[model samples]
Target: MEMFRGFLFISIAMILFSLNLSNVEGRIHYHKKQKKGSPVEPPTYAPSPDDPVSQSPSYPPPVSQSPSYPPPVSQSPNDPPAVPSNPSDPGNTTSEDCVFDVMAFGAVGDGCTDDSAAFAAAWKEACAVESGVVWAPSNLTFLITSTIFSGPCKPGLVFQVDGVLMPPNGPDNWPKTDSKKQWLVFYRLDDMTLTGSGTIEGNGDQWWELPCKPHRGPNGSTKPGPCDSPAMIRFFMSSNLVVSGLRIQNSPMFHMKFDGCEGVLIEKLSISSPKLSPNTDGIHIENTKSVGIYDSVIANGDDCISIGPGCSNVNIEGVTCGPSHGISIGSLGVHNSQACVSNVTVRNAIIKNSDNGVRIKTWQGGAGSVTGISFENVQMDNVRNCVIIDQYYCSTKACQNETSGVYVTDVSYKNIKGTYDVRNPPIHFACSDTVPCTNITMSEVELLPEEGELVDDPFCWNAYGIQETVTIPPIDCLQDGGPEAIGESGTYGCY
Candidate 1:
């Protein structure tokens, strides 16, 4: 009987796989374990016509010697619709400057001596009360340090920035690495909203020495990168945080890093940094869950959004990028860490003039599993590397690539449309050569790539397609950026 049950399970799974149904498109269904006497409703799947597998369940060849079993339902009279939880917090209401009924913040834009004292005063006041608007009015360069973000995480606690929260300039402008204080940050805050038509500038040049780290230490640098200004907004180990409709730019490191937090909503935010800046990931999230990032614009040299280790149950949708590295997961398993990223979805995103469009990059020889990840309805233009799934992406100095072996599994991409203009290799699906990637699937993904000159990938003809295949054009990454003329203006940059 046990052998028979194993056979039955394998048969069902095999039939589902053969039909080429993506996890996103409801092409596959399996029975989940249920309690005795409990009701069981089989999932509905949309199977492919080209597939020989059953669209509907078919009966097994009869057990001629035994009593007959009941057939599964053909249709149900009534069933509750399934609801996929989105990361967006719709309850976060929109508010305009001055019209807001919350605590007013930051010395009303005097443009004189640093407004840190004023900002400190207002923020402290807002915290003292249960709820209020904390405003950064126009023209104010609010300088702040080690401001504790103790919030009720409620709408009553509103943070409005109508002006600039600028970081101090020169070396003195650096966030005190001695302690994680210097710039404005939020920790253990909840149900709080940061909304305004203003800017958060960190005078970052003072710490230029950090980025050129010739040494190594904790947090990825012994000598921290100059880009490591205290975080723009650090919602550490907190949840239900909402940041909407604000321009959060010029951070030392991450524009906003929500670490180990849940129920985070970042909407209509313009998170920016200089394109040449290093380690300035627009948003870096790690060890968190239930987060939504939508309707936002991010321009940076690093990952627009870096979904780091131990992240699960995340939804990233409807975002646009500029001069970014696109969205990514992993670079995990650093410093002997066992990280797992799972149950996340990214959809309806546009990436322009970026290095890589959408990717999952893992430390080639780490111990972690990246599973059940979905990318849907992605549109790309002028992208350098349209798609990548690198399992052997090693960056750490201690890595012995020839010895350490890691693998990636169960990743899906659906309905991706893009054009790669640069001449480099657009798609590098170099999964772990040893422990090969398993159950990796793509559907309805197309890439039209062209550089200054034509270059093609012979192996690319066989990629994902729901209705059709992923398309790719040819261009030379090396030749595309060359000078058009040999004289004055033509003597431009070199490779």
Candidate 2:
């Protein structure tokens, strides 16, 4: 009876796989606990039209038997987004006229001291002065508690972080009066440069063990609690900002979050966190515009860079990401919300030993459109899902599929060469049945297996696109013939 049940489960899974009805989890964990066998070799060309495997453009069959149930959904560490610190000192060599040092405003550089007040005082002083410098002296570890640096500050203010700034020890150490949503926030600031080769540490060891974290519960279930963890640094509703030349690490949640901000430039930085740290996204940008992220190294638990809802005109280049979930355009349109994102590009990047390469994910029951995005000149090494577009992204297995879906179209992948982990498919584009992805183009994509095994085939469902050049591990799965509504564009601009 047990053997019969197992056989029945395998038959059901095989039917689902053949019909392209399986979810993203089913596709990713297709190799879970399988019996050892000879690796399936990648096909050099598309299957013949009459071939049984040629019925769909979705991925070809694996050698292993399909599992009974889908794997658990990988939830983002960030949830229940309600919305969207400190200081200081002067032992500086730069003798600027508008220098407002925190130490001058009664800031103790001691690592144990709560210097939030002093940092706030210095910012207040400098916000009024043009081209002012809020200096945190070198060789100091200034401990700061929760603080919000509200701004519409004077143009061209520089917050030179030459030392270390750390938050409170843990949740137990947090002050009841302060909100745990975000630790240090630059709110509504303009023409500011937050730069310098300094370190901003979240001291997030305790936060990772929280009940709400992904690995804390049985089968990745969540335990009940306040479950709120603070983001390390957030720029909210700020414009003309530059965050560069810093080392940020170990965030309770997202290391850097930009929400409702515009005209931002992030460059020349190193961001990191433990691979086990929950939700420690290197940099997260949302509801922001005209942002450029360049020349950065990010090794973190979550996405190296995440482009969230209502974001446009984002450009990322010269980034090295590893030991992380690679750059993601989203798990957007969550909870049936509308997500509008466009004009994003990620190029000249390297992603190694990451869970994903370049991914664009959206939930099932949502509205809005994602268009005019391109991923070019990206190199991957041992990446699990080298390139993917998963429209039915549910964080829980219990989520029911909905007809309403976000529109994803006009995406191009160019010069994406890499070696992928033998586990997951090299490319997976599982678009919604309702709103099919259109005008997807790929060129010069060569993904081989990192280990000495055969490469996996690309997977596609309702993904209509044109391949400009022949791709490695041939994307025979990508469907041809896009809709007439696409190919030509007005609002999203001609790709």
Candidate 3:
């Protein structure tokens, strides 16, 4: 029995020893695996939190704590902890919304002629802006002559002309493209804005067309025609330009012309014209795209709005037109010319006391296409011819071959409400006899005369190039005016 008891004790002791050895071996294997490919190798010793050294590319075991462990560095006088030097940074990473005072930026505080020099300096400071704003504070009248300021406008260089920019009023002393008004013209620039509640007084007495009616010219020489002159504002090959909150008046020619621009927003503007001036249109856009003219008032002698050839995606909304020839599309081309006008929308516009409204005037003969046009929700008061589309559009200027071979196609006129006068008919739809109007659809045309005399002068010329059946309603409201309608003799005569 004693021998058996000793054997049992020896066996138990052996089992216990085996279990302890297994635990030791497993721990060692696990620790080796953890250290083999871990992102954070267990440091031989914990490092101090104050240590400035970063992880070295050489992932060797750290040596003894030494001063060299920290990166060799120095402090810069101008350098901040976290900022960049380029002040015009788009992100404003430096957070420098330049707090420069107007006068400090070369703005003349006094209302005088010396403002030209100050304006020149202010413009220079605004040129190199990635996102910079230049101020033109109040209480200053800046007189500018012919000054040309070239522009490849940076993302955020603004001309905050808070004061008046008076345009010199003389042909010899006027601000021409070579001289003045070039102050803020941008060429092929993106994301630029000119916003202010100031005025651009052309003081256009000298610029106005002196009577060329066989009378002495500016040099006291004989000249032809009624007058010889053009407008004030001229833009060439610019993009993403915004003109807002401005009042421009007394323009010699067309008030505003946007030539070869894309993405233009003209809003909250009041443009006027001298009622006696001839051929003075409100706005003329040529070869432009994605343009919007909204919430503005235009009063001029000629057409309130004229869309030249090569314009697309244009929108005119919430506009008030008066003392003008009304809205027109194309005088097309003179001869042997090509034009493409498409994708235009005019809505919610008011036409008052004008010769015509919602008009599309193309030459009788020319090569052009006007498509995807819409005129909706229009109101006209005391309008001579509320809606006029003259394809054989012979202007006051002499005719060439009777027609210019231009074509008008794809148009719509909906919800046009107006009161026709006695002398002038409410609707006159005259398409070209050769190049007909195609896909021209009109609906909800309410033209009832307020005058008593109802004479019937209804006419519809053939739509030359179309196969669809064209129809003219027999309302007889187009030809004869009501009793109260004015006399109709010449272009402006209301009989």
Candidate 4:
């Protein structure tokens, strides 16, 4: 009985040992499978609070947490990000709100009604904005009296005209309270642009017929009266201005004038008047600098382009002038005031049937100097005195000759070829005896008589220069050496 009991105990012990060994083997196999499949499965445990890489948001969050994530779409890498279309933003101001129409300001577009008040209202609103346009609608004519468009306005201001602008009909209709010196004056403006396909008509027929005009009286006599005719348009003390694409006609006096201005540009303009009209200069500039006038046409009685005192750095190109006094430097130093001009260039011009071509005239007893002037590639047709410099320019028949005069130096003429009137010499250089002209250069000049044969030789008095090539009607009269010492006129400098 003891032996049987011992056998039972041994069997039970063996069975229990076998079961324990099987459980250990199964745990080892499960661990091996988990190690092999680790890369494909998500993490089963949370990260520690101190792990910086696990806390960072650079990686994508879970789908339920990331509500603002954009959908996958194809786009260029360089393209800008999309923005909302918000009209209330200052940068997105609409064009309709920026345009200030004159009609909206209670302007009557009829030919007779006065529209100065409406124009002033429009200008006030437009000038107040950051970038504004003052618009004159099409198919209308607005009569404006002598008015001033004053400004120190915001930048990017534009005055756009698509219609006609007319002044009072004649001197009879002119308002007595208005000043007759200027009409349509623009003052104290910067970065302003005046552009239009329009007409500015100055009804000056009666003003021109006044007896005070030169040679208008019987037998060319002067009738004593206060003769004040208004300039059509004048710009004063303005900078960085542009005027383009307009037609101006029939001015009482000067068509357009610029005074005390800088950085001015004028292009593609047309100016016309009767050839016999008095004091109707097309474009005049005084005390102005850094100016450019290009691609324009002028047919007027007086000078096409006049450069007055204190002007420098002027450039004129591609201009056509007819029936007018061709481009003149000055009737400077009137009443013996100081005048200085320098660095002027005129190129690629045509002067046809004009009174003079490329002239420099100064009154006697004038101070200061004119230097660094050039005229190149000019064509003249039936012009009188194709190239001239007259130091003794006087309006009256009898004038006193003074010892002091403006010094003229460094003038050049190149490639000037054309026909000239036979009544006067093609080239006349009547320089001041006291302040002789110096450094006058000429090249490739060929001027032939328009009517008869060439009867007169080129005239020169106290002018010195060299000719690079043989000229027609050879100018042997020019002195070969430098100018003589300046006479009693004291040394002058730019003011």
Best by TM-score: 4
Greater-TM-score candidate between 3 and 4: 4
List ranges where model 1 is wrong by over 4 Å. Answer: 1-108, 151-155, 175-182, 208-228, 396-398, 402-407, 452-455, 458-495
Compared with the true structure, the alpha-carbon lDDT of candidate 1 equals 0.58
Tens digit of per-residue lDDT, candidate 2, span 352-398 = 99999999999987778888888889999999999999988987789
Q: What local lDDT score does residue 275 receive in model 4, on the 0 to 100 scale?
A: 95
Candidate 3 stretches with Cα past 4 Å from truth are 1-102, 105-114, 175-184, 213-230, 402-404, 453-458, 464-495
Model 2 score (lDDT): 0.78
Give per-model TM-scores.
0.67, 0.79, 0.68, 0.80
lDDT order of candidates, best first?
Answer: 4, 2, 3, 1
Q: For candidate 3, lDDT tens digit of each residue in 32-127?
A: 332211123212332232434332122222111111121111111222121111111232221123212245534444444545555566555556
lDDT of 1 by residue, 1-495 (tens): 999999999999998886665565675578655321121231222222233411122211110010012111111111212112222233333222212211132243444345555556555565655444564544445555556656544444566675676665645643454333335667677656666667777555444336453233455565534433466577787766667778777666667887778777677788888776666788888988766676789998678999998776677777898788889987776654566776777788899888888888766445666666777788988887777776556654665663232345456667777778556566666654444455555567667664455544622221222222444432112121212222211111211
Candidate 4, residue 460: the lDDT equals 98
Model 1 / residue 101 / CA error / Å: 9.9
Number of clashes found in candidate 3: 25
Q: Which of the two, 1 or 4, has more TM-score?
A: 4
The per-model lDDT (C-alpha) reads 0.58, 0.78, 0.59, 0.80
TM-score of 1: 0.67
Model 2 TM-score is 0.79
Q: Which ten residues in a row have the lowest lDDT in candidate 2?
A: 80-89
Candidate 2's displacement at residue 5, Å, is 99
Each model's backbone clash number: 25, 3, 25, 0
When sorted by TM-score, best at the front, the candidate numbers are 4, 2, 3, 1
